[model samples]
Target: MVVTTELVGLIHMTTRPFHNLLLPRIAVLLVLGALPSCAEPAAPVHGGAGTSPTQKSRPPEKRPDSSYRPPRGFTELQSVAGRVARASGHKIVWRLQPGANPGPLVRIRGTVNDCTIFVHPLAARKVPPNTWAFLFGHEFAHLTENLGTHSATSPENELQADITGARYAMAAGYRIEAFLGWVLTEPDQKSDSHGSLHQRVRAIARKFGVPWRTIERESKRAASYRAGR
Candidate 1:
């Protein structure tokens, strides 16, 4: 007969003359065991490829003042965003959020919140007309895909957005290839949020029917120019 320690303990406890006295205490302990421990925070819920922690962490650090205004070319970007939304068949609503303004007419990237596309002031001010159009096209494509706040790290979703954006840009007479070349050459910064540059460039090229060799050549040239080599 196998007498496991647990069974032995149970037998011993049951045979004890004091077992009735321990019953109330044992019941209390059992009830207490059912309660959850408060030592740690509950895990955050995620839906599909939602925004990463790194991307979410940026907002508080980069938050602008209440009175902060969007940079120049706001009107132009708004117009382009509207056009791209219509072209992409999403018709997403647009809103400009506060943030530091830097780079050309485009610098920061826009994000989707619900059915609305939120553009940062820096993004609005830095990019050229074509880049601006392409960016909005990409964001609006997210809406068309019904991907709400999906993580940019999702390669499939990101590529889909890029393909849709590229088509919209080309239709609107924007130089999407040039924008893609610039993107491909830029140093890797947001890998957790957007995945690898090579993957992105390849996906965009494949989807848009652009020759990968041309994009690769252009990216290398752009990189060399930036490096002053």
Candidate 2:
């Protein structure tokens, strides 16, 4: 069939085998059909949302990190990201890559040539799909900001991304305290990378107004900020 040859050729472009690529045209069409066409989907909250939610109403609660598995409802994450990208007048590509951060904080690492917003396929698939979406947004913030810069030397750029990501995550109904609990606990750094954990968490906390107590506790500066308050 005319369609068959074209489909086969396209499949051949994949690293998979010929037999693997040889699927019924209907099956291929169905698979492609299900995916949303988001050519230039709307940008997400590029310029910040209207107002911040007060953390005063809630008790001092500790939210455990969300499951880090392959995403079950990842499409929603993509749609949300698309909106942010559109709003920001930017774009992002989500992919499952090797060497995802083995820790809780959603990792966002990329370079100039072949950048991708990584989503732990297995982690994203588990419960608390919102966690994965938050990570996706976090990475996008990095990508979009980095797009405006030439090198990755700016720690402010990264912190800005963290703030951007936190805003989206908070707006998306993810517990900022919970998310930051996992993030601030992280105790490693690339020598060439940004500042200490205290700096990063504070940067994100300020953006979402996640409460001064929360940051103080995470940074182990609780007594310091608390005494002043």
Candidate 3:
């Protein structure tokens, strides 16, 4: 994916320290297969670790800003996000933006204490709930594992997130196969930060103790079926 000037500017802004406060790591989910380094500022919120419980307690949902009208499928996105958050035991604030730019499908802001996930309206309408679970799971893994502040390489951070995120998705009862299927449709190219599609798929499969070849076969079939339709 081509990084626009606006995104570059935003990235620069996020990296700068503001008021001597610790900046939250901004994890961007690139739909077209690029990844950016994390650097952003936001307040704090408490989060938990480990897999989600079989039965989860519903947390109080935060209402969106009244000034902006929600896009189509926003409600469904909220529902799915809530489930993922509960499964991860994290309190997240969700926002929907009107821009349909081909930059990031989701932008995570804020530290562990005050985290907000910004989703583009286009992603809300177009991506499936199960896929969103994996995306959310990946970001939450970053937050929970403190991958942003660690000295690990970018690819290492991303691979770790993929493994932990798959666990979170499973705990939330979302189908892992759905996420694998979606990955099949994404560009297989690698970036300076994110791994190639194959690497991510293998990491996630290992998390579930699934054979790489099995997932590869199944995912291709699923992708083919969707394409044929």
Candidate 4:
């Protein structure tokens, strides 16, 4: 009888805590259910290490500007353009257009279409020697991928050409300053056919190891000039 009573007592002791826990839970559920129907729903809990569920994440920052500098060897214009073209495994036929209207004058310096390159002699004579060479290099770069004018207006293609052309110009021994004079003096806005002067200048500056400050200085100078005029 004592053993039976002891076993019964142990069973009661073991179930006491379980019964206590269940009663509170049931009471809580009943209290929640009895609350006013108009009560606001509980806020949802999120499970992340950092950042709130309602907050939007910020976009990534743009890449920092970089600089490059090339060694000297800049000489003949055709030779440099040839080197750039050859580097891309292409051979070009150079053509000189007669009049300004049908030449580079009508279309801003030079162009490479298919296997041929066209430039106006009159237009060539107007810019600094290094810039002239750079122009040739730029056009040659367009022909490098054998894409020609088909990708002319594409920003990606145009940027690639500018970067490649700048490198070619550097290889040909032209300093970044050579093109900066013309670039700063005549900043072209973004167009359907080309990038903004800002984009071009930044690309050239990045490729040739020129400082962004130089462009800033030139822009300020140009702005001042315009203001003065």
The prediction achieving the highest lDDT against the true structure is 3
Report the error of model 4 at residue 139, Å: 1.0
Off by over 4 Å in 3: 1-72, 91-100, 149-153, 221-229
Predictions: Cα RMSD each:
24.6, 15.6, 14.6, 34.9
Record all residue pairs in model 1 with backbone atoms less than 3 Å apart, i.e. clashing.
49-151, 104-126, 105-125, 105-126, 105-127, 106-126, 106-127
Alpha carbon lDDT at 54, candidate 4: 46
**Candidate 3 lDDT, 1-229, residue by residue in tens:** 2211111111112122211121111112254333221222222221235424421343523322111112225665666667777787666554434343444566565555555666654445444566777777776677767655223337677777777767777788877765675565554556565546556776667767776666666567555533332
Candidate 1 lDDT over 1-229, as tens digits, reads 2211100100111122222333344456557774223233423422226868764675652533111212234555566666666666554545534433221221223333333344433334333445566766765665555333333225555666677777776776666666666566554333354555556767677767788777766566445543431
lDDT of 4 by residue, 13-76 (tens): 1123323433454456557774222134422322335656343343322211111111112223
TM match of model 2 to true structure:
0.45
Ranking by TM-score: 3, 1, 4, 2
Q: List the residue pairs that clash in candidate 3.
A: 44-113, 44-114, 45-112, 45-113, 45-114
Which predicted model would earn the best TM-score? 3
* Model 1 lDDT, full chain set: 0.48
Off by over 4 Å in 2: 1-115, 125-128, 147-151, 188-190, 215-229
Candidate 2 per-residue lDDT, tens place, 114-187, comes to 35444433233322443444455556666555422323345665566656765655565556665554344344
For candidate 4, the 10 contiguous residues with the lowest summed lDDT are: 2-11
Name the TM-score of candidate 1. Answer: 0.52
How does each model score on TM-score? 0.52, 0.45, 0.60, 0.49
